[model samples]
Target: MDGLNRLPGFEILPPEAPMPMPAQDLSAAPRQVRRGTSSPPLMWLRRLLVIGGALLLTGVATAEMSLVLGLSRWSATGVVLTAIFALLSIWIALAFTSAVAGLPGLLRRSDPLRLGEQSPLPQTRTALLMPVYNEDVGQWSARLSAIRASLRAAGVVDGVDIFVLSDSTDAACRQMESDAVLALRARDGARVFYRHRSRNTGRKAGNIEEWVRRFGGSYAQFLILDADSLMEGRTILALIGGMERHADVGLIQTLPLLQGGRTLLARMQQFAGQVYGPLIAQGLAWWSGAEGNYWGHNAMIRTRAFAEAAGLPRLPGRKPFGGEILSHDFVEAALMRRAGWAIHMAPLLPGSYEQGPPSLPDLAVRDRRWCQGNLQHSAVIGAAGLHPMSRLHMLVGIAAYLSAPLWLGFLVLGLAVSFQAHFLRPEYFPATHALFPTWPIVDSERAIWVFGGTFLVLLAPKILALVAVALSTRRAFGGRMRLMVSGLVEILLSSLLSPVTMLTQARQCVDVLLGRDGGWTAQRREGEEIRLRDAFRIARGHLFLGLALTALAVAINPLLAAWMAPVLVGLVAAPWLIAWTASEEAGDRFRRWGLFLVPTEEAPSGVLLTSDTPGAGDDRAALVAAAMAG
Candidate 1:
């Protein structure tokens, strides 16, 4: 295709067009000579201390369990169970410790750098770039108009430009996008522009690189956003101001809150993010003062620094594990840091927002792609010259997916041990010639203590988040009773969904390991009713597993059945739970009851205006209608 045909919505300009040139000398770019006060050694020390402490506690618990098992008769199955239990214990403990560390930060609410009331208007030009792939063009135009209006209101429009770069493959979607772009241009003029690529080579990262090569020199910084992302002008100004003040800072990421949820699952996700996300993000920012990781969107990057250092090289080999890196944000951050530029996170910065998947199936689809991307990091983790912290970040990403399978294995092993204890004959006489008859024994009391401890660790973070909110922002989320009740509901629902998520992730991991590639696909953001038949088809494996376990537990012992009830219940009811939570009525009912309510949902910010709202620009409904008809 010709250049004009390749990019449907924009004209192919001559060489004389005001496009920026690439840097002639990369060494002239600002580079940090020394690490920030939160030095690598100190950061590692803190992380190791927390991890080491958790491991020590896990060791003690495992040793006590071993002794209890030894009281009756030591068995191989018991040893395996103890090991898995210890591993799981350490995982929970690490999270609990992070939350404990973050509680003070969240309660204090005094990150002056992030919460500064005033910042000088940025002098540098910044491009607000949004990459879309086969998305709803009408909705995209609405969101873009809202953001443009927000910037104009803040008087920051002079220094900002908005671009909608499309990698849409569907011809109808591309044509709709072209019509929407024309409408947006007619309303907003030169400040808004759009370009559609016929062949979206290398996906989003490539789309960004093409922009950088063509127009990167004209802008000092670029704010990358996803299709569902929304940001207030003030927050954008704050991010750019931070970059301007710190010459060596290459990127600054903000914590985005989930909003615009209309399904039960989405609302629950919004609530969890609002309540629990801060503590976790605060903890991360505490340790990763400068070497923070990027989350691909709602982030600003120095144009020159990114251009010089973050040109991603394709990995060797084929699909699934190699070729193009799907998760490029993390790698880019690491590369920028390695080239002596700092990456930071401003968790306290408000106004960054994004939408969540509407239901379990939608989330699972997105998660499958993420799972493959993260697993591919195993190859990148050992790349030469990467900072130790960067390696840790990659490892954590890998572990996040791997833990699902580990948990599943742990549960399966526990079931196996139970079966052996019930059905297999015990060897009373030792092969080494012991005279005394050995009895297989377990200390029920110690086992109870271990279980209680694990449960406490698992729930402590949520409790801490509740306490933090109550102490700091109680009025924002209604009264204490409402908050507590909502939390309880969230916990109950999460417990029900945890097994389903576990099975989904475990299956995805297994599929990736078996050489299956999760192709990049656009996520469905709008809520829709899920039929029972579809739900059952999606959750068939979970049902089969749950049924088999239930039968085995019944045959073994009623106590075993009781012990496995939570997992079994979730697996068996996965289909119903998915269908029910996906319904709009279910979500509306919860909202009416003030369950899982968020402050944003209660009162939306001014930046969230719809296209129909006055001052947001001309309506694009007719444009969308015309394009759809065509």
Candidate 2:
């Protein structure tokens, strides 16, 4: 009874292997170190192409918008609207161009490092570090067991060990977690270890650093896994093999597919990720090359490199903008790159999987937390010695959240412009000797062209992703017709949900600006049903905003109202939409009709099959009884 509420017979943790992880100084000069993998000329060219293309697209779109708004007689409101539109347009343009650039890689399914089944496993010891925080014990245990089984089957389990790092504070939950691990250890012995920290301290990053300081010396590399992460053993071996083969490489990230989606929202995410994720990831990999980013989980990291280079320092100040870094992965990658260690992405790697948020509300919670983390990156973007690409990575992360507010401002300004058009009388013959009156006119025809073009750009990535799938793996998604239908469903749902998401993220940005902390909260993985009251509670703001927009649009003009119908409808129907999508029944109904059919669901791997079964690893009742008996 070590005061941790540790279950009897599972009181001891594995012996510690001390390793130093010192805090990094942002102002320190760059380290002069050994030569690492150099970024190819083509990588630089790819970056130039994507960046230049986005800028060109944004410039052209902004010029068109300016013309539509009567550029020569541009009002203050018109200028502001144009600025916001330009800001918003760049992100979408970048995405469109990036997808286009990545299409070839996606089509070819390129494996740049030549990693395959023939790759040899490393002899060095590795650890699988799964950090849990008030998560479902049974589910995670089962997943870990399946992973263990997977590794054993691959003949690499002998060199790797599994560590269940618990930040769970609940005594009962800790007991259950301990009980589950006890059962696992009973079967597997010292290969499995469970350690609990009384204080969460710096949250997940801290939990990991603590582990590094305590036990990192025992392992040459460690793979980070989210509570929901599940990897096939071969994928794990391949990542290790990559690290071993490329000694200069510090980290390697995999594009984990969203699997086990049982809610409508989750299914949509899965479908979209399966269809669209490849192009985006490939594009990233193509441009990023050796200077790639880490996505926190389903990734492998060189233990020494991380310990030596990725030590994070707390920023000066309080709450949201300062203190502990929230988005640690990006900063870690940047630091490692600064230390001249190559970071790479293996987008073509398969068998890396993760779960998605079960509902929109759940997504909002996660996004809010991430919003704070990304916004905090503003302080670190200017840190000395960071690679140019690393700086761009942080900047893009901040821009991702900022784009929501920019969109809101754009919409609001457009509404104001419309109101001005309907209410204010145009100055006819303002100049005493004017040849013709400037009618405060908006070029409706030109505006249509601009709108259509913007819409097309926004839709380009999805279309490209669909085309890539159709060309390569149509049968994987229930054939071409079903895939198309699923794509349509995903697009429609995403469009309908966009406005709500925008408002939510806009509010999150505002909250962060107001110095509110999102704090560490447990994510709801299981797709629990959303009741009407809860749905209404969650969506009241959206509902109110929707109604306000609808009224304002109608008052301004019938055409304006028609133009805003989709946004207004989504806003007004937020409650029903959230509830309906969160329903397991709705998800099942979609499944029955072959909608949102991802390959993982159609054809599960052996590990997934094992996870679905009631094994001793996660048989909670049996574990509980066994622990009590012990």
Summing lDDT over every window of 10 consecutive residues in candidate 1, give the lowest-scoring window.
Answer: 12-21
TM-score for all predictions?
A: 0.89, 0.94
Q: Tell me the TM-score of model 1.
A: 0.89
Model 2 clash pairs? none
- Superposed Cα deviation of residue 161, candidate 1 (Å): 0.7
The candidate maximizing lDDT is: 2
Residue by residue across 66-122, what tens digits does model 1's lDDT show? 776664335577767677677677777777777877778778764634435576777
Can you give the lDDT of residue 336 in candidate 1? Answer: 81
Against the unseen true structure, what C-alpha lDDT does each candidate score?
Answer: 0.77, 0.85
Superposing every Cα of model 1 onto the true structure, what RMSD results?
Answer: 5.7
